[model samples]
Target: MKLDVELPNPQNLTEEFEWTFPVGTVNENGDAVITSTDKSPAKVKFKDVIGSQRVTLKTKLGGRTLQESVFNVQVAYNKEVKTVYFAAKGGNIMAVKVDKNKTPEMTIKPYDMGVKSGQHPFNIFFNDSSLYVLDCGRQFTYINDETTQNMGDGKISVISYDGKKVETMLTNVGGYAFYDPFYGYLNAAEKKLYFSDRVSGFAAISLDARNQTMSRSNFPYFVQSNRLGYYGKTMMYTSLNSAFEFVDGTWWWAKINSPTGVFRFTNADILSKEATAADPEPAAGVVFKNLVIKSFVVDVNAALVHVVENSSNALYSVPLDDTILKAIAKVDDIKTYKIADLPIKAEGTSAEPVSITQLILDKETGYVYFGLCSDDETLYKSGLYQYDPVTKTLTPIVEGMGVYGVAINNAKSKLF
Candidate 1:
C-alpha cells in the first residue's frame, strides 16, 4: 500500500500536505476535529485541517473483523522483530508478532496489575525472565511472579529477574518531589534508577547488584531533567534550561538552547564548589572543566537525539565522535513533523491532561515511541508508540496508558 508521508515545516511552525492512497484505504483525516465535550464522534469539523495526520491502510495483519484488530499498537520500531509487547487500553499485555513481511499476529496476556485509571500502561520493564509492569497510581506488579507491592513515599520499584519471579527492589529517592510534572518519568538505567521530585532536583539511586539494595545520591543543583541515557561511567540528562552529565568524579552542566536540539557539553569549567558554574570568575582563580560529553541518546540504538524548543518540533542530530566529547556537525533532516498534527486521540475526543510530549527508543528494537495520552489530543492521559524508521511511519501499538514516565528495558526475547 502507498502511504503519504507529510513532513512538518520548521519555520512556519505549521505544515500541511495532501496525498491520495489506493482505493478502499482510509487515513486519519485532519479535517474532522472534535472535543471531549462533544456529543457524537461522527460530527465535528475544523476549517483548515491540513491533511490527515496519520497514515491508514487496509491490512489483514491481525484483524478479526473489519473494525476489530488483534494488534493494538503502542509503539513502532525501525528494526524488525519477531515479537513486540504493548500495554493495552483494556488492562492487558499484547504481544504482536509478524512474519518477514510485517503481517501481524497476536496473543494477549490478561493479567491485571490493578490499573483502573489513565490512558497508557503504568510502565513495562523487560528483563531476562519476565515483564515487570508498574500500573501507574495503582500497584507495582509483575506477570511471572504474581506479586504486587505498594510504592512507598520517596521510593520507586525496580524489578530484577532470577529465572523465576521478578524481584521487586525499592530505591530511596523521593517520587512526588522528583516528578512533579509527570509521574511516569521514573526509569532504570546503567544500574542506576533516575527520577525527579516535584519540588526538588534530580536524584539517582544506585542499584547494588550484589545485595540488591538501592543507594541514593542527590544531584547537587540540577532539577527536573529528562533522562538521556548512560555512557561509560556517567549518566546523561536534559532539563528545560540546561543539560547535565553526572559522574562520580564531578557534576557537569551546559546551557540548553532548545528541547529537541542534540547537545554535547564540555564541562570545561565545572566546579563542585561553585553554586552556579556559570557565575563570574572566582576571586581565587578558575575552575577546571570536569566532564566532556559527546552524544545524548534520544534513541540509543538509532543514535537519534534532539533538544526541542517550544512546541516547534524542529528535530536535530548532533553527530559526535566515539567519546561524545565533540560534535562533528549538527544535521537537520529535510523532513519535519508537528507534534500537534499527530493522530493521538481516540476517534472522537478533546485534548486532555494525557498528551504525548517525549519520545523514547527501545534499544533492543531500534523503535522510536512517544509518551501519549489515553486520547491522542490529551497530554495528561499518557500512552506509548513505536515508530518505524524504514517506512517513515507511526503506529499506535498501545493505548489507555497514563502520563509521562520513564520506560527503559532491554531484553533478549519476549517471555511468552
Candidate 2:
C-alpha cells in the first residue's frame, strides 16, 4: 500500500523536529500500530549531521514498502564575517567582505551619515568595533581680489558596523580653508584621534575625555607663534595632509607646505603639558628637511617609511633606524636627510602627471596601495594602484573612481 509523506525545505537541523503520520485502522484489540525505519514521527537529533546531510524515511509492512521519502538538511553557524570599509569623494562608505584573495567579493550598500550638499566624507578609520568618519562641510567665497575664506560646519562621526546607529563625536572642526580632513589615525594606546586639518593645523581629539574638542596644542610639532605678515599678520601654522603612524614608540607624520618633510615626536611629548604663551613653542622633535612629503606610510616591521612627493610625483623610502632618528633629534633646525634610491615611480607622463592622493601600507604583505588622480577632471585616469615592494612592480587595481582615501583591515585581512 502507498503512504503519503512530507518534509521541510533545506531543514536547519539545529532545532527539534516533529512529524505526523496518517491515521490508520486498528486491529481487533482496538490499538493502532505504526513503525518507522529511521525513527520518523519523533524529535530528530542532528548532533551527528552538522554540515550537510541527506535523510530518508521508509515504512514497511510484511517486508513490503509502504512509503519512502528523502530530504536534505544543512547546518550553518549564524555570524558575520569580517569586513573592510572605504569611501571616495562625494560618496558614502562602502564595505566589502574579507576574502583570502584580497579582492572584494561583493559591495554593500552606501552607508548614510546624514550629510547635506557641500559636505562629504573625507576619511574613514576602523577600530575594534566602530568606524570613525570625517565629514567636511564648508562653503568658500572670495573675500576680495586675492583672498578666499571658508565658512565651516564640519564634523567627525562614529558609526557602528551594522549601520544602525550614528553618533556625532565632534562638530565645527576646521579643515575647509585648504583641504578637508583627508587623513586620520587612531591611537588605541593613547585613545586619541589624530587628523590632518590644513586650515586649523594638524589637530587631535581625546577619546578618553568626556568633552569632544579639537586642539592644535595636541600637536606639539607645529610652532603656533610663528607669524605670517602677508595681507595681514597671522600666525603661521603647519599644514598636514598625510595620515600619522606610530612606529618604534614614536608618532611620525609629514606636512604639505613649508618646512615640509617627515617628522616624529615621542609619546611623552604628545602627552606633555600644553604649551603656554610664555613658552610659545614646545620641544621641537626630529625634523627631516628638503623633502616635500604629501603622504606617507610606515612599515614598522620593515623599518622603512614610504613617502610620496606631490610635486615630483615620485616615491621614496626612508630608513627608520635609531641612527637616522637620533641624528634628526639632535639638530636644532631642520636637517638634511637622505632617501634610498627610488624603488617605484609615480609619475605618469610628461603630458599628464599622476598625483598620488593617498598611501596605505600593508605590513603583513609588504604591499603599498596608492590612490591616483590628475588635475584635469575630464580625464578618467584616476583610480587605485598597488605596488609590491618585493617585486618592485606597480599595477593598477581599479579605474574610473578617484580614490581619496584607502585603508586596510589587518585583523580581517581585507583591503579597502
User: TM-scores, in order shown?
Assistant: 0.43, 0.55
Residue-wise C-alpha lDDT for candidate 1, range 61-117, written one tens digit per residue: 122212221211122333343444345544434344322343233222112222222
The 10-residue segment of model 2 with minimum total lDDT is 223-232
lDDT of predicted model 1: 0.33
Query: Best candidate, lDDT-wise?
Result: 2
The local lDDT score (0 to 100) that residue 286 gets in candidate 1 is 10
lDDT at position 162, candidate 1: 24
Alpha-carbon error at 278 in model 1, in Å?
Answer: 5.8
- lDDT for residue 209 in candidate 1, whole number 0-100: 31
What value does the lDDT take at residue 184 in candidate 1? 24
Q: What C-alpha lDDT, on a 0 to 100 scale, does residue 197 get in candidate 2?
A: 54
Number of the top TM-score candidate: 2
Clash pairs detected, candidate 2: none
Q: Quote the lDDT for 136 in model 2.
A: 52
**Residue 335, model 1, lDDT:** 23
